[model samples]
Target: SAMFRDYLSRFSLNPKQKFKTLSRGMKMKLGLAAALSHDAKLLLLDEPTSGLDPVMRDEILDILRDYITAENKTVFFSTHITTDLERIADYIVYIFKGRIIYSGLKDELLEKYCIIRGGEDDLLKIDRNILIGCRKHYGGFEAMIDIESIGGLPSGVVTEKVTLDDIMIFMNRKGENSCF
Candidate 1:
């Protein structure tokens, strides 16, 4: 009872306020408080920050960080917002079209993929099967590729580090039949 009351106060939730009257952010905070009150070893949160303002989102993230650090807990957070994942996740699992595209350490995933950009002629020289996703513009094409798959890149092609958002977009674009 004390723990629940403490959490409610910590989240600034009014004990007298009816649930139906609470805003989305307030509701999320209440949920967070309830989850923490149980002293659970694991937390599965889906889009906890969705529709929350920046300040509130930041506060939630900080609370999550504190939760894990204080108790050696594990949090499985799923979200479309890659920036949130980048901020707090040490491991990542990417799912696309009911398929698990990747499951590994966040750093390893970042290391394994890259964005490649080059003229259309240069792009044509590369095998389509190796490309994760490709977008063609008026003069050039940009594609996501596994770093290991690149052997000797054509002269005009440039490679850049891939972000979490880039990986999601490209992999989703590839769909079911594509390979990475």
Candidate 2:
């Protein structure tokens, strides 16, 4: 919080002389708000939201939407902004060491993986091949599955909806420490 306080202080806002300051709707606001909205058609952002407040994050998203959806520009931002990604990213390409690992649409990513949870005995009953990655809990095992082979999962293991973040974590873990 202090870091944010320090950052905000850099702006030096004066409550008294409000007229001296530019309006929020001014072009400077648009530019500073969307630094990526320059002549470059493609934007390559890295950790753009790592230190932003929630309100600022939303504001940045607004700026991005204005550029991408309204202005018809292309963005190539790399972020852990899963919430933002769900709303904006049309395609995601997982990269490591300049190599591409997976590239596809966001919706397809959610559809491909699922979380299966059950007791160890219940897990033993299910086909091992269905499991992609697993984490042992106090009472049960939570597993990520690429359930393409079977028509449906086993009775003991219930399939739960997986988010994009879940799939990304599963893929990263499955790919060892090298996935990007």
Candidate 3:
């Protein structure tokens, strides 16, 4: 009861408000309060920041950071909002079509994948097995590749750091290698 009250106050939720009257953000806070009241070592949240304003989203992320630090707990958070993960996650699990594409430390995932852009001719020279995804356009092509899988790119190709959003898009797109 006290913990719930504390969380309610911390989130600035009105104690007298009925659940039906609560905003989406307030409902999320209420869920967090309930989960934290237990002795569980792990917390699972699904799109907790969905529909929340940026400020409220930041607040929820801050709360998560504090929870992990104070309790030495693990949070299994699932969301399409990559920005939130970029803000607070130390590890990341990326899934597409019910299959996990990547799961590891956030930094390693960021380092391991890259966006490769080149003319269609140069891109077509790459082995399809090494490509996470690829798209061919009128003038050129861009693909996602594991940095380790790259031997050496053709002269006109360039590689850039991959973001979480890029990973999602590439994984979801139709590609020559559909088995990722």
lDDT of each prediction vs. the true structure? 0.87, 0.64, 0.84
lDDT of 3 by residue, 1-180 (tens): 888788878888888889999888888888898888785799988888989999888888999999998989999888989988887899998877888877889999888889988887786677777788787777788889988977777878888999988888887774655321
Question: What C-alpha root-mean-square deviation, in Å, does candidate 1 show against the real structure?
Answer: 2.9
lDDT of 2 by residue, 73-153 (tens): 887888777888887788888674578866998778778778877876776666655666566777678777875743565
Question: What is the C-alpha lDDT profile of model 1 across 1-180, one tens digit per residue?
Answer: 788899899999999999999988899999999999999999999899999999989999988988989889999988988888888889999988898988999999999999998997898688787788887777888889999877878989999999999998888767342321
Q: What's the CA error at residue 169 for candidate 1, in Å?
A: 1.6
Question: Which one wins on TM-score?
Answer: 1
Q: What is the full ranking by lDDT, best candidate first?
A: 1, 3, 2
Model 2, runs deviating above 4 Å: 1-39, 96-99, 150-152, 175-180
Lowest lDDT sum, 10 consecutive residues, model 1, at 171-180
RMSD of 3: 3.0
Pairs that collide in candidate 3 are none
* Candidate 1 Cα misplacement greater than 4 A, ranges: 175-180
